[model samples]
Target: DALYVGNALSYRAMAYMDLARMFEFKRTGVAYLDEEAANRGIYGLTVPIVTENTTERESRDNPRAPFYKMYRFIMDDLNLAEACLSDAHAVSAKTDASIGVVYGLKARLWLDMGSRFERYVDDLNTMISHEADEDLNDYDKIGITTANECFARAAEYARKAINEGYSPLSESQWFDPSIGFNTPNNSWLWANIISTNDIAATTGEWQSFVSFQCVEANWGIAVYQDEINYAHGWMIDARLFDKIDEGDWRKTTWIDPEDAGASNAFITKYSRGTNLSYNEWRNYRSYVGIKYHPANGERNTSTIGNAVSIPLMRIEEMFLIEAEATAHTSGVGAGKQLLESFMNTYRMSAGESYTCKAADMEAFTDELFKQKRVEFWGEGIVYWDYRRLELPIERGYPGSNHARQYRFNSYPEHVAPWTNFYIPDRERDLNKGVILNPDPSQAIPLWEGGN
Candidate 1:
């Protein structure tokens, strides 16, 4: 019970830190006093913490307070969990696994928060060190400063999880059509598995819910597919993909055909057969439908296949993060040396010769983004990268109106008109003090007329 509650609380805290990092601007550049003022003011003025049993009066008076409180509570709980895990042996089946997960979550949260606040750097460094020490056995035998170190850490945890008998189902297990589609597999680290009946009967198809198509079909969803796409695309800068020699496995796996309109082809890392509809039908819903029909199976029953485990954290990201962080602190050359080692391993895995020299800082950074994008295509970390880097959203790649439209016309701009529009009630309530809403005419145009 203690472990469960502790893990849950820690995960929640990590999520709150993630949100604060993404939504709020960094407090690092501000004056020390100003930073303190902002932190204290936000902490005080913000909503009080509340749980499921929060009173209605408390909620009504300070709606946002509970969220803030919950974040604080999460941090406290995570600290407690770390302490508890330290003394206890790994006698329980799930204790060690939960501890590792909590450590990873804390590391991610701290890393993100570090970008926003100066104090968070020390916190993040501490967390990373703790995780590194705890999960040392999982790491590949490599020097700490090398690019391989990051990959080694990522791979270590991932391998530990797998070796401990927690792994995602293989492609064959997920695609096999002989078993019932609902059969659960061991690969899912954590998931909310919904019923087939609930899924098929829903108006939105599975593909519509999970893929980039979700944005086009429904604007209501907060996360945009284009944002995700652009974020991932930006990571593949000239340094990484452009430098790869012809016939490299990463080039084939990481990059799609760079063509526009009908000629464009998507990278295959996240690509399943056709769309989700076809894949769903192939994997589940054995009945012959418009989208899919089993080669042989009863109605509504198809051979059970393995589901793709949405990798929350893999070995690859750790490598990139370590390399990037080291590059930022140490010289770019040191970082490149680390990156090259990983690249060599990657090439060796594909039976190819690895050859590349890390020379310029700009080139190294570019390569970092490229490798990250190719490695973590669909797992949803791209937006975080852009936010951390403070890069402006570039529309339509290097040159194009379509790209500009997509980039500049963000969620804030779209919602601003509605938020800051003139209010008739305000005008009526305070005649002499009527709020002067900015005119639409004065607003900067995000893009010129048409493509």
Candidate 2:
């Protein structure tokens, strides 16, 4: 129970830290914006001026907590959790806290925090080196020092989890074809494994929320089928797709064979069997499975078998974070060297030659973005990456861009100036009419207008 709670808290912290790094302006001592520059829009809009009390009421509070505060809170919680779990002894004869789960979690949290706060690079390096030495486990510790060291670390941790008897579902273990929906592999770290009967028994609420079918059924909520297509396609950035080459295994694992006749050719990472009922198969809920259980009336029931062990902190992400931070701190050349080394490890593991050169930082940064996107797709890291890099959110289908634009617009009103959102009316009333209405020109307009 303690370990689970610790892991959960650590995951939350890791997420917040990532956001903090992405949104907060680096404290460069001098403010970059001057009155003239500000008029020219050269310095970019001032970060939205927000105080602790008013921050919560700003337009950007959808996920809850302002960006800066969220990071601080996450860091505090993660630090506390790490401290609590640091000395925890492992109970399994083969696995203990020192050698097993705790170390991986710690290494992950440290690297995540360290990555965002460049000052913590050394601390992260120390943690990685320490964990690699202590745990000879693969998934938890993959490549010691290689070109793809970061990716290797991630792979290593995943490999360790698997090798340590973390079972992924096998073909035979999948549900019967006639029953619809294949049984999830036992190897899942955590998953929302939904049975067909579970869907039929419910009032389609479970199927609607969790399945892609929600797009069609929940059109009133602004959800639609094209939304899924947009999400899948939007995730396919050029940099990441290019890295896969023609026949990489990772690509094969997620990308489906093209169906020329279908409106959308590409499939998704999660595959529902053909035999599954349309209502169950077509919906995201069916694909991801329901988050709640009918029996206990509790959400995220571990017993109902839908609890997917989503890898919150893995060695690969740390490796990338370390590489990026190291490169930023060190010269770009030095960072490229680290990145190349890590990539080579990935190549070797896949029986391919590590072909990247460490000569160009720009190219290397591009590669880093690519690898991170592909490796962490569907794990909820892309949104943060887009924010940190200040990359525009573009989706091919309709409503996708609107959703992202809404998020971006909310940022300025709720947190910082770079964020965009209309000033709240309540604030106008409370602050003696000091609230400034958001400028329409400042909104990071969506990529598409309509579906």
Candidate 3:
């Protein structure tokens, strides 16, 4: 198979996993608190798996597959991908589905499957490899499973990344000033460039979505002295600004709404300052997402247009994955150390460092997810993190200032959502076995008596 086969398999597997997450209930096997609660999770696995080539009519008429059957299909494709992709290929303008990415995908999939499966730990080990080429002079390999070993391996992988001359464009890589999320650095393993050629407004990528969510309507910096057609419609939640910890360099990237005398806090990642030439200043939309910054350099991509790379997998995520898996398997202490090291190195400002030992497993996991949300905000993958755990869809505590659409209403104000998008009607019609999932509550968004 061509290297691309691995990439396609990876993408297909991801699609199924995401659908499974939306349609199936949390799989930690804790036993849903109640039958109603279980129903809210779509306790029945109704989505189908078609292994053979079939038409929409045939596919629609096919029966829904069991949960394991679907995952087994995904794993099958991934295992094949692992065998096909190279041990590691240096990243380029177009990142290949390298063996490392294969491993990273496996780690994520296994984590979604939860504690019953331990194979993902070994998968991570293999992907990082022989201590992830740790010895600057030595190519010997080692396997790790326990927390301590995992921690050491994770650390070494990060270390090897540096030793191999993989430096952040600067110390501010997290809220990267130069690339923000646009630049692919040594830290990036797989990144997909979205040229204006790739831009789709009706069904757009991160750039379009951010333009809708982060930018104010008609907020394009047209007053500036350059030509680029861009606009904004939404803004970042002020509460999210309140969440950034002091001394964390990322906190400085946004203009606080209060200080700015505005109702919403806005991120600098996309805001082109007022009265600045769009060509010289490079800020296009005050409410636009900078993840795929506008690049006029590409042919036909004029000043502040979308011609930037979208990061899919980065070394930063690998560090967190190892830390999380280590905590789950080895113990909180090992995992905690790895996480603290990452924050100290990648997240903190000059002369500022933060460290913690989890009082318990839950505490440690909490910290890991928190770091994930902040670090990966606007990347559009954090929703899966919450869904995998079957956690509530909470924006803020009761009576908080979060916008209404951002906040869900339930008894106690935090339970299942009243609304969830179902499989599109077209899919249901084309795929005969497909059925619609119901809201957790018929009358309200939360379960009966749920708060």
Per-structure clash totals for the candidates? 23, 58, 13
- Output the number of the lDDT-best candidate: 3
lDDT of 1: 0.39
TM-score (all chains, Cα) for each model: 0.52, 0.47, 0.70
lDDT of 1 at 249: 46
Cα-lDDT of candidate 3: 0.52
Q: After superposition, how far is residue 65 of candidate 1 from its true place, in Å?
A: 7.4
The runs of at least 3 residues in candidate 2 whose Cα sits more than 4 Å from the true structure, single-residue gaps closed, are 1-76, 87-210, 213-235, 238-240, 253-309, 328-351, 392-442, 445-451
What is the C-alpha lDDT profile of model 2 across 339-442, one tens digit per residue?
A: 66666554233456555454565566666777777666555655555444434333334333223444332221122334323345665455442323333344
Better of 1 and 3 by TM-score: 3
Better of 1 and 2 by lDDT: 1
Candidate 1 matches the true fold with a TM-score of 0.52
Better of 2 and 3 by TM-score: 3
Give the per-residue lDDT of model 1 (tens digit) for 30-55.
Answer: 24422553544432222234456666
CA lDDT of every candidate: 0.39, 0.39, 0.52
RMSD of each: 11.8, 11.7, 9.1
> What is residue 417's positional error in candidate 1, in angstroms?
14
